[model samples]
Target: MMRQWGLAFSFLISAFSGLASVPPDAAAQDRPAVSQCQAIARTLPDVVYASFSASDVLPAQARAEAVRITYLGHSTFNIETAGGVSIVTDYNGWYRPAATPTVATMNKAHSTHYTLNPEPGIAHVLHGWGDGGGPARHGLVVGDAYVRNVTTDIRSGGGVMEPDGNSIFIFEIAGLCIGHLGHLHHELDEGHYAEIGRLDVLMVPVDGGLTMGAESMSRVVTRLRSSLILPMHRRGPPITAFLSMFDDSFDRSYATGPSVTVSLRSLPRKPLIHILQGV
Candidate 1:
């Protein structure tokens, strides 16, 4: 799987580099002011959507439109866009993959979710909490992907609410919108929904208590309405409990391997829970 992804990623890097460069000023002028979710929701097709569960059999030429998602255990996922942008979510000092990511998104809820000293090779290290301000704000576009964050409160050791202590990082790439709910502590509100818009894929922590109760997280999942769900940050017992919360409205599948390639064309007609095997 890694070998196949590497080939595709390298090809995309070369292909994207050869494209005519857009001046920063001109690119900024073309960017929309609305959130990615709202933008995708407006353009959703009326026909029934479909999903093709692919392991590592994709052709190298399809790399241009494919977004490969590899679970790196816990809440960390390596997202490689067709434009060759690489991102690691909830990046801890450990669970480092062989490939050095261009962007690393971290949260402060626990030591395992962040690192103060990241590798020098990483170009962008985004923290979810503020350095001293209210909440951290990240809006960056690299190659073919745009990354941004939405703040959420977390529970302190004493169980007190730590405002804006966590983040929900959203990545818009390859014409698909993906979201990572990092260390979510409480249920979402209207403001969150408005900011989140429509997600084609969601990476959520289903550890029952670490992030939230299974029932609570399930409700949040229902509200988000993502076409595909990736489970993370859970052991066997927790994963089983979390799975039981979903009803007939959703379907569940276990991946034979750690990575699954996706594209806008492969999103499911109904919501799905994909249990990737890397963990």
Candidate 2:
């Protein structure tokens, strides 16, 4: 039954993509600004999972149209889009890909989760917190991707709740909604979920202590239920402990390398916890 549903969904998405591929002059005037992923979420209550094996490498041509996600260790991920856009999530100074990204996002929960000075040649730098008293605001479109943010609170040095201190960045690219939960310190409310929309791939902080506890973070994972869950900010026992919470419901895959290429049509059929190489 589930298999049949997945096939149908894939077919429908393929047809939708065909229509979307029409020249911009033909559909630009009629197309809505809302992302394709969010539109699907609004119409379909449940996001049917698609099929892709993380271990299978694709040919160069197919990979050119896909998004490459590299786990650069310790809460940083370099996300490269097929259209030549590269974004670094939780970009503290130390961990980074060889080439500077087109955009870099940072959070203020800790020093490691952010950096004061990023390397040269980066196109944009988005801070999760605002320089003034207000919350950070980011709605940027570069190449084939649209980047946005939903503000969330964080715990300050005194352990008091600081409102709108963190941002959960969402990257909409290639008909997929990829999100990074940056130094998340609490469970999400309905409003936060609404703003975030649906996430096909989620880069989550699974440290279990500094961000949030295993149990609480597990609840967040259960609620989002992203097709692919990439655990970042990993510490030994917490990674194992967090996976245990979803052992029955989610499939676990340990990728041979630190990077994985994914496309809209290549999402996993079952919810998967994909652990990449390196901490």
Global Cα lDDT for candidate 1: 0.77
lDDT of 1 by residue, 1-279 (tens): 455545544544443333225643344356532343443223332212233222233233433387999998889999998767899999996977688999999998888899998888998999999987789987777776778898999899889998999999999775577999999999988767667666789998888887888999999888786889999989456577888998998989999999999886678889999999964
**How large is the C-alpha RMSD of every model relative to the true structure?**
8.9, 5.6
How high a TM-score does candidate 1 get? 0.81
lDDT of 2 by residue, 134-182 (tens): 9998777676677889999999978999999999999977667799999
The TM-score values for the models, in the order shown, are 0.81, 0.81
Model 2, global lDDT: 0.79
Which residue pairs collide, candidate 1?
none
